[model samples]
Target chain A: MKSGTWRISGRETSSLPLFNTEVMGVAARRTRGRRFWSNLVNGPAARYLFILPTILFILIFLGYPLVQSIYISFTDASLLRPDVNHVGLKNYAQLLSDRLFWLSLRHSFQLTFTAVALQAILGLGLAVLLNQKVPGIQIFRNIALVTWVIPIAATVVLFSFAATPEYGLFNVLLKQIGLGDLQRYWFGNRDTAMWMIILMHVWRNAPFYALALLAAMQAIPQTLYEAAQVDGANAWTRFWVITFPYIRYTLGVMIVLHVIFTFNNFEFVFLSTGGGPVRATEVLPTYIFEQSWQYYRLGYAAAIGVAMMLILLTITLISVRLMERARRS
Target chain B: MTMRKIGYYSAVYILLILSFAFLLVPIIWVFLASLTEPRQITSGSLWPGLRSLTLDSYRRTLGSADVRIHLRNSFVIASMTTIATLLIATLAAYSTSRFARISGASITVVVLSQMFPYVLLMIPFYQLALQFNALDSYASIVFTHVVVALPFSFWMLKSYFDNVPRDLDEAALIDGCNYISLLYRVILPCAAPGLVVVAFFAFVSSWGEYMFASILSQSKQTATITVLLQGYISGRRIEWGLVSASTILSIAPTVILFALTQRWLVAGLMSGAVKE
Candidate 1:
């Protein structure tokens, strides 16, 4: 049978709305089941399904290589060898004293920081200036994007030639303009080579940041600007109070993305100088290449690769966290 | 708000024009240098003596020193990779957009993969290539290039697919259309512009790629245009005429493509960033 009714103190259960309560409970359970099914059958369900192939593609083709590289970092693997020996921290320990490795690491950091900072600053400036509604403005904006669109290899070669010390156009132009002292081996001198790399990086990458920021700027509702103006805010005040806060998140994302791109860049430096003039321009990636391919030190190169990955992973994590926080706040 | 306004507008215009000049200078220099004779280029003057302008540099660069082979290789590799990337990326994007519940994990994988930055993997990829006896082959470069381009293309196409209305698919299905026809007849047409954008990006990216080409392609038979240009620049002595001329030629296609798709490119990028 069923459970007994309550005593007089808590009785009157039968007098309660038992039918309604039971009906409501059953409806709630049914609604939960329908929700689960709807999520499985919705448009986003298709998106989730389609995305799986991409995930698998990246994992097998790219992820596997990354894991393999990390593993090789701890082993004595060479290009010519058929087998790898577990060397534990030997490769890492050797890297500690490797002068060239240190130099390359220094160069990578210098180049990454300099290029990213300059790019952000210039990009921000351009984005702000271009955000104004001026006539024939789209034409100027298009021209600004030219550098970013052109193939990097082409720019690298062109700049290398243009900045050439002897017969380069820049030198000739300077000499003609009476700045005869301004000309020197642009990509040849150790002191100037890294600067040239940073400059080229800035020139090529600044447009991308500008474009991203401009998009973010355009997304801000115009009503806010009108409200700011009504409150007696000047252009500068309006930007500082309204525009900056809205796009700050986009700026952070751009910075992180550019840092990754700049740190991993090898094309321009390699094309221009080949980490030359006595390895002065040798960034980490180039150093890895030299070790593995040029010197056949595959194991040591893998170690360098692992270290670069760790640094990049750390940067990426911090970037993602900042991005998430920015979104939330 | 009268004459003062005119003056301010003119000043802004002038500043923008100057910035454009800076942007165009390097490319203009290449074009001008390409037209100049070696003798004039050596003199380092912008005004190539009208009399000194010649096609000699172009002829020399395109000559049988195997420049043609490199051009062909570049075309074959870039085109093949583009096709492969579009095929794989489209399918994956379709599956993702049509079926996936949360793109959180998938998008993360794609973004992180991109974060790896091809440079870090160069050594290991090379070692693997050698192990598989795939080094120095066009297929090797193509396979590697596919990997390089797939992530970006997938991300791009997926975002594009997201813009399509779900009702389009549902309507097609209701009208007795299968998934294949729905994709081909309806969704593909809808996503045409985005597909073009993705394909062009993949093509240019593969074409301009230098590091892997330098490492993997052993001879002129497998060389791409970028590597050839690098060789000209880095030889025992610089061939300024050939280097500058070839550089101009190499950039011409991309420049023209960007110019043609200028409007679409801006719109595509803007939409992708903000919406997705």
Candidate 2:
């Protein structure tokens, strides 16, 4: 209490014992309102008060929206049309039959799988390299993380520096390398558009994996590696026998984190490609956003949104199970 | 052995350099391109000479009232989100840390909620906004941004509180400081660094959000800077320099915040996630 400088107000009551029955008695004699507040703040009720705001925020903000989403998905709701009729899974039925919907769903998973796989592989490689006892590696590690720091919107704009047609950076570089004919309008070509989206995803996320995995690698006991080296284990053998086991948990967690992230990712595809080049890069989130906003098909968008929820739920469960299995071993 | 070690390190150094270049080329170009004259980017001179660099594009981009409104919108939303997330998440985190009754269900809900497909939440949130006539209002956008930041902020702050030695809390209680006083006086001050990181995380997430902003705040009145940049971010033959300048401006706040808070942010985030 002597060193407590936080007593900025220094009220007389602040110095008093928190649950003073005498103060409660004085408050009880003075007014019921005073007793309530003191009990509210200073008494056991403060525990509920501490939790009240979060519960209220979650219930009103998250719970309500969720309930409204499932409800609206069953209705024929459109912003353009006034009436919202209960259509009973008509939107989902249409979605299942719709070729474009399936295509976008497939694209979503394809993009997620490809990007996650590539990022993990590339990330592990980068992590191994970065873990070496080389000078200036810290600077390189920081530079690598710069990609993760730039937000999604800015990342799109940065990639557009190379994505713009004839005058873009990649095209210009191509010309210098005598591959001017191979210069591509990346987001415009169907084959390249999806790849461009993947490229951007990898460019932005791989370093995060590297950072996490490197931290995991660094956490491993150095004596284990030293012991292996003394037993004539080579670099490859040491990494396989020692390094891989330790970093797997961090790697698994990072992969799941990014998987959910990339799956629900709307900004990257929507901003970069707008699901264009004939919808080659169209993923579930972008598809739903387009349906809701551009087409004003609210009910249909909600159905797709619900489908997205289901897929994400499954991925999360499977990842959890995998993590548990790994932990047990 | 020495020669093999040197050879191995040389390869590692080369790969590291290439990786850095791959990651940084666009970032370096954005900085350089934001300085070039608007005409140079469109005319195929993507890399302008250092002597020709100018801030003309940045000057012109900032002069627009539309951009100013969008920037203000982002600032208002992000600020509200930071303050709200800090207050709500910290309180909940403290309660959960001290009381085990709420921790089990709360942690489960919070973690599951993160995987709830943001797009799934988008339309319902949109309808909720329209239903309450909160469309284009700062309250509507700020509410949604808080939701986005809540899970992570809650986790981060909870872990920070968890790590706070219980001895401090007991000492405060013995000194007659109630839970509220103990939290405000001892726990919060100890977790102040975590609060800073969560606040910055909330600010950055809300600033960069686009889908919710586009839906809930359709009009320019409440559209965030991210939405504003979307209009100029296309591949049209427009002045790339202007777009670059606006982007740099929009991202400046987050970049500055990240630079200031990177150490605590990275360490806290790693520990927070792994604890799950």
TM-score of each: 0.88, 0.92
lDDT per residue, candidate 2, A95-123, as tens digits? 98999899999999999999999999999
lDDT of 2 by residue, B52-109 (tens): 7998988888888988999999999989999999999998998888853567798778
lDDT (10s digit) by residue, model 1, range A46-138: 434545565666776688888887788799888687888999999999999999889999999999999999999988988876776789888
Q: Go through the candidates in order and give each one's DockQ.
A: 0.30, 0.48
lDDT of the candidates, in the order given: 0.78, 0.82
Computed on C-alpha atoms, the DockQ of candidate 1 is 0.30
Reference-based lDDT, residue A318, model 1:
83
- Kept native contacts, as fractions per model, are 0.52, 0.59
lDDT, model 2, position B132: 93
Among all windows of ten consecutive residues in candidate 1 chain A, which has the lowest summed lDDT?
A1-10
Runs in model 1 with CA error above 4 Å?
Answer: A1-56, B131-133, B270-276
